[model samples]
Target: MENYPTEIQEAVKIMYEMRGNSEGMMTWKNFPLAKQIITLLDSIPNRSEHHTPYDKIFILNFIIDNISSSDTPRFTIEIMEKELALLKEVLPADLEEYNDPLTAEDIEEELQMWRDYIDTEHFSNEEWCRKYSHYMKFDPIERSEIWEEKYYEIESKIDAELMKEDMPRGLGFCFAYWSSKHKVLAEMGIEWQSPQEMNPGVVFD
Candidate 1:
């Protein structure tokens, strides 16, 4: 790891420690993929002295994505779980830069936004259907009333239903929206604040 950036060196040390042999020897065979990753990180040009949260995210994503590629043996659930758990032990804990310090209020806000997004999209579809309904010469009056009543019924009860049953469904919606938002952030080269428990598969990796 000599001559590598300090951040890369630190990341290498963490990876090595996570896969260290019980006999106190650093064995490359313990984690062949990790070795390749270290090599790749070392080869990066003009590496920075300290890796920002975003940089570390890129490195983590690079390692995971490469290890889970089609050319390689797919990462088993156990391996993926262990790697993520071990990485959490070594990676920096603070993630304010990612704007994902979720709280009860934050979750509520996100959930509301999620609901609004869904509502808007649904209404748009309804509007399109309504426009098409006007062109229907066959029972247009009956059809239009049916569409309007359906929308009204759903709109009236959707919120109550969402917040009903101890709000379990609403909570689910919150997590769903939060997870998707985090995925988008990850794609944008930003670190995710969430632990990504629901995304156990490689699709989210």
Candidate 2:
């Protein structure tokens, strides 16, 4: 554990905590494939500092995407195995060779860029409204209309001066990593919303 970074340690703590909780324990018991993947990642040797938590991040996202809930029947062994095999095949042998390691500063800078980007006249208000409408407490149809109106009203008053405080909170390192990765991809002329397409089992939202 001393060899792992703080982020990786935290992720490992969470996975073990999940296994300890009653609901999570049941979920893990039912979906041993997910547990197996975590175990496999935990066994990787001589992981570089720069590549510290990517493996843990991958495992967490895999669990979220595949294990719908503790009570759901969505955990399918065949599908999990297929996805895992595909991921191993596609993953680069040397991830550090593909890109530099993302840091907290990089995340903050990227998020600030997002704030600036959203302030520009080119920002899509409708898309923003649609993306965050799920957070509204109203009924689905009502929430959509309400959020649309709310966003437009705020947009009109703000006049393209979107601020960082207006952004979502509690996104954690996974999002920060995704944002940094997205910036790198954009510079390379690649357009992808999620890294899952290229790095299977790794998703950000």
Candidate 3:
């Protein structure tokens, strides 16, 4: 696999830490599997505020599709099957039909939401400002420019990755989307075991 950008590495590191790993994994290819597992665990009822009921199932499917198409050595057939089973175990019985495909309109709306939040709520909203008060000390103009640049970089990479799967404009929203999602998942109250936990003795095959 090609080298991942520093921004992606940082995102992956934060996610691993979210799972209680003191040191983030260096292997990038395995990230899709890890991301899928986290989404599955977070989907469980009452697991976390981020729990989207069955919405996580769809996200898992999307991640799996990407993994299947990527030319990476991160996931073996055995590991994939194990992870899928773990995800299925949490599915709610009688899940109502869900067919909300991410459309161009939805992407645009999401992008707008991100932009609005960053430009307004990021520094004005009490909770948001309180949580990120340290960053607030920076010059407003410089800070805004830095954030916009980072968002552009991350979303640009995401756009390229999604393009490879013919999923243009799929997940190129902004930092807010990922940050809120992970913040919610951090509350996954239960001790959700991931596929890596199934074979703790091995790092990766």
lDDT (0 to 1) per candidate:
0.39, 0.41, 0.38
Give per-residue CA lDDT, model 1, range 1-205, as digits (tens).
4765654776666554544431332121224545455555545542254443344444554344333211122222223333344334333443444544323343344333323323433545345346435321221221232333232233224334433533443335655444554554445444434324423442332
Give the clashing pairs for model 1.
none
Q: What TM-score should be assigned to candidate 1?
A: 0.22
Residue 118 in candidate 2, Cα distance off native in Å: 27
Candidate with more favorable, higher lDDT: 1 or 2: 2
For each candidate in turn, the TM-score is 0.22, 0.24, 0.23
| Alpha-carbon shift of residue 45 in model 1 (angstroms) | 24
Clashes of each: 0, 0, 0
Clashing pairs in 3: none
How far off is residue 5 in model 2, in Å? 1.1
How many backbone overlaps does candidate 2 show?
0
| Model 2 Cα lDDT, one tens digit per residue, 150-173 | 332332233222223243334564
The local lDDT score (0 to 100) that residue 119 gets in candidate 1 is 42
Q: What is the C-alpha RMSD of each candidate to the true structure, in Å?
A: 22.1, 19.5, 20.6
Cα misplacement distance, residue 147 of candidate 3 (Å): 35
